[model samples]
Target: MKKKIISLFIILTCLFSSFPFILAAQNLKLVSNYALEDPRNLFYLDNNVYVADGTNGLKIVNVGDPNNPQDQGSYSVSGVCFDVFVAGDYAYLANGITGLQILDVSNPLLIDEMGSVVDSNYAWGVYVVDDYAYMADSDDGLEIIDVSDRENPVEVAESSSGGYAEDVFVLDGYAYLAEKSQGMRIVNVTTPTSPTSLGVFNDGSDIYGVFVEGDYAYLAAHGSGLIVVDISDKNSPSKVTNIAFDGMAREIFVENKIAYVAARSEGLILVNCTDLDTDLTVMAKLDDNSETGSGDAGVYVADNYAYVVDQEKNSLQVIDLTASGGGNIWLWILIPAILAVVVLIVRKSTAKKEPSRKEKLSDEEVEEESNEDGEESAVVGIEESESEKEEIELKSIPEEAEDSQEKSEESEQSE
Candidate 1:
């Protein structure tokens, strides 16, 4: 019964999954592209985009023109970096081996690592609040530090929360941690020395990345897709919805009403995040095309242009939003048009003999099955007849042996 149900489910899924690969069509305009590295994170401040180029350290690009972003300078660090988040003039980098490295990007050409927490056990992400820096270290957990003096930072507290924390986002006096596998953890950091875990929302999916705005938590869940949760009610958190980008979401950043998503190799995706009820509508997509450009890592919007870090190509791809109306989708028209064509095709196909190909068996096949069943029955009957004959022969042989034994005993007594 279980096998039958599973088979039926698989068949139904296959039959219903014949729909066309529906993708929102958008008119894209290429702005510029520059050489970089496996740039995983991008921090946009005004026209400057500070990208964390994994092993290549950090890159500072002037994207004022959008179309022609020039790499002003780059700061080399000791370890590979995962992301770069800028609070003020200082950029907090989540360096993998070297822990968290704080740099002063005020002077682009002369960037300096103000201070760092060398004792951290593999920092995966970082966030800054006022004079404190929150490092999401895997083994060290959430390594809290005092960054009051940029030149010298100090570690204060660490919260492992029984999970591996990756990213940290500060809101008000609370910190929303992107705890990989364990989900999102909301911690109270009012007292930087003693940060407390207020609430936790396990997304069930592998929570790799996360972004926050106001009272909402947007998580880049690996297999389960992009998860959006309502963080207004801290204790009793409720999930709003999730937009499955149909790919692995590596990074997510939101500015105003637009959301920039770097979906690994799938490329950069722009969507409207204001409306969570809908599948964060896709605005535009950037991929490896001869006419267009491609990128991943951290995505940010500044001065109407989108800055995407192409991790593999080690390039900075600039996209023009003005040409795409800030990515306003018209799928309403396109979906209907595609549906109309499908309907017309169905009607034409139905006009013909659309017998589901299940009744094409010939009479010879039925006869063959019947013959096979007869052969099995004959084999079973022959085996049963052999067993009855053996039983009868055993009964006769036993009685004859007993009589012969008695006769032998009587003859010996007479002699």
Candidate 2:
């Protein structure tokens, strides 16, 4: 009975626990592609893919129709543009050594530079929240800029991370910095002008990109794959878990707890991070075998389509995530329910077969069983007694024969 209770409890727990994955499960497939020159990283906004085409500059592609993407515009810059962040009417570019370049993108056809801020080191990544722009300046660490005035963006403050800051993500007044070899650094950026370090989580993995949502920060830890960090407690952030793959995880984008990874060597890999308590699940993978690209460098997911930029193939590949079916919430629920019912029925059948000791027996039935047991014992005792009597009689007969022989010998001697 105890064992049955335990098994039922375990089954129920598993059924309830799987709800998160069932609700968030999805698969991906390559739907379309757009050619480019040395594309590195990309950002998706309002159905448009803004790609940082490495020395070729920023190329904008509209992916309103995932099946067929079209080039919308192009803006060339002096240095190698590594990253881009579009906000409102402007687009911010993290142009390597050339520093930050802000562009007025109100008109997609005619893009023009609105402002610029030079960086001492390479500007690897950029993130904009409100009026401030946060940059991951390679060797120089985290650089903050005031972009309230797009025409004249000013240098506000700077925070030095111990290693090369490759990417930065801001969420709930904190800046999560992904430093190449130094792991991750959490900073309190509530005061943009006076940023302070809260904590650091390093497991010796090289972090290339970071994306924070809610209380967790997802990192593209290059060869280490996708690592999830617990940022719920800012003062002491910790590494929660990680999912490894063959490719070099370059950039990561999370939408609705699904992490889309641009695994350079392995192409695009999608992970189901809905249930953090369990091992991260790989929902789908689109390798480099297709026209999508050879070495995927960047990825951005929006409206069921994943936009991946291939640095080697120098093209943008649009993947349809809904082509492969997702786990129907109703189906998931029904499966567990059916299993539970089957388990109950089997248990009930087994219980019926094995009568419980607690069940009361009728007085007449009990008396009849007791009489039958007594009769069996009596028969066994009578058989044993008969065998012992037979052995005694046989021994007595041998003694009598010997006495008769002695009497015959005595009579013969007397004669």
Q: Model 2, 32-99: lDDT tens per residue? A: 87999988899888988999999988999988887788889998889999999999889999999999
Worst lDDT 10-window in candidate 2: 324-333
Q: Give the TM-score of candidate 1.
A: 0.68
Task: List candidate 1 stretches off by more than 4 Å.
Answer: 1-25, 278-280, 289-295, 324-415
Error of 2 at 78 (Å): 0.5
lDDT (C-alpha, whole model) for all candidates: 0.74, 0.84
* Shift in Å, residue 247, candidate 2: 1.3
Over the full model, what C-alpha lDDT does candidate 1 score relative to the true structure? 0.74
